[model samples]
Target: MCRWLAYTGTPVLLDTVLYKPVHSLIDQSLHSRMGVETTNGDGFGVGWYAPDNGTPAIVREIGPAWSNRNLREIADHVRSPLFFAHIRATTGTPVQQTNCHPFRHGRWMWMHNGGITDFHRIRRELALAVDPELFLDIEGSTDSEMMFYLALTFGLEQDPPGAVARMVGMVERTGHEHGVEFPLQMTVAVTNGQQTWAFRYSSEGASRSLYYSTEVEALRALHPDMAFLREVSDETRLIVSEPLGDLPGAWNEVPESSYGVVGRKGEDDLLPFTPQPV
Candidate 1:
């Protein structure tokens, strides 16, 4: 349905993955091999942690990314240790800036590359599930954004994976009540700038694609002559919806029904995610 990537590791220019990869995110917008559709040109967005303020900076527009000169220019100049890039294809939802992915809530930033089944049937109940105090912050009509807010309402800042599991459980329950099967689907990326977490799951048991980078040291040993690879710190990593290129050993598929986080210490972790009905 869409293509997205999340990176958390060494600080590097945004283009390293956005434009430099052979089948970059920009290219994926026009030619995706694993997504439901090859063309995801509905819109694009990029968010990164700035050097001055780790508050998270975002640039989004409802236009094809390849045609955006501003994005091209910024990609060459801006760099960050953590960032998110998304290429969207609408799923029966309005096209608008607020609907753009890599959404922010104080410290957290999020984006998604899939849709919820029978969304309209369950939208009202899902929305009503949000805490009243937090519901006012919602700014888009897409289930993706609502999913983000739902996670926040369920303690996302304190626990991203837990919040997401809770949100999915809620969606599944609502969908079942509405007689819709396999109601949740997503390849999601969420970050607090300092740390990042990604999830791949679908109620139908076949989720969208997601992948993460190998450690820089491992890559360096495998492809020693690559100059650009040498420039990056040993900790550098990238998670994408598709391999940026056909480079041998450049990416690894995320396990089925699982999620991973990127960072030092316990900040970067991955665990099995299975939501029991509530």
Candidate 2:
């Protein structure tokens, strides 16, 4: 449905992750091998946390990323320790800037690569469930942004995985009430400048592709002469919809129905994820 990537650890130009890889996000926007659509041209967005800003900065547009001059210009200039980039292929929503990915609220940023099955059938129900105060902040009509707000309503700031599970639970419950057998499909990423969390899950068991980069130390040992590996820190990590490149031993699949966290101290974790009733 979409392609996205979350990067944490080491401050580097956005280009390092967004444009430089052999099979970079920009390239994916044009010739994606792992997404439902070969070209994700409906829209694109990038959100990054600067050292001095509390809230993340976001740039979104309703255009293909591969040909966006502004995106290319910014990627060459902006640098951050953590950031998210996404290319969208609308499931059914209109192609507008607000419908782009990497949605933001306060210091947090989020993006997704899947959708709620038959969202229009359950859209009104799900929107009604969001907290009134938080619902006002929603600027997009995509299920991805709706999921973000739903997670926020369920306590994303305090407990990310729990909030997301609750959000998914609500979606599944609502979908079932509407007679939809498969309710959700998502590989989501969320961050609050300091830490990043990623999830891969769906109601039917089969989910979209998701991968995380191999540990920097391990990659270093595998290819000692790679200068880029030497430039970044041992704690550096990246989670993407697909492997950014064909580097040997460079990516690992995130387990089905599970979530992972990349923390400040390199205390990353992978654990089982289960939807809980709200």
- lDDT string for model 2 (118-159, tens) is 899899999999999999999879999999999999999999
Give the lDDT of residue 68 in candidate 2. Answer: 96
lDDT of 1 at 157: 90
Error of 2 at 223 (Å): 0.6
Q: 189-260 in candidate 1: lDDT tens per residue?
A: 998877788999989989898988777788888999989898877777788999998878888999889988
- lDDT scores in order: 0.86, 0.94
The segments of candidate 1 whose C-alpha lies over 4 angstroms from its true place after superposition are 264-267, 276-278
- Name the runs in model 2 displaced over 4 angstroms: none
| TM-scores of the candidates in the order shown | 0.96, 0.99
Q: Which one wins on TM-score?
A: 2
Best by lDDT: 2
lDDT assessment of candidate 1:
0.86
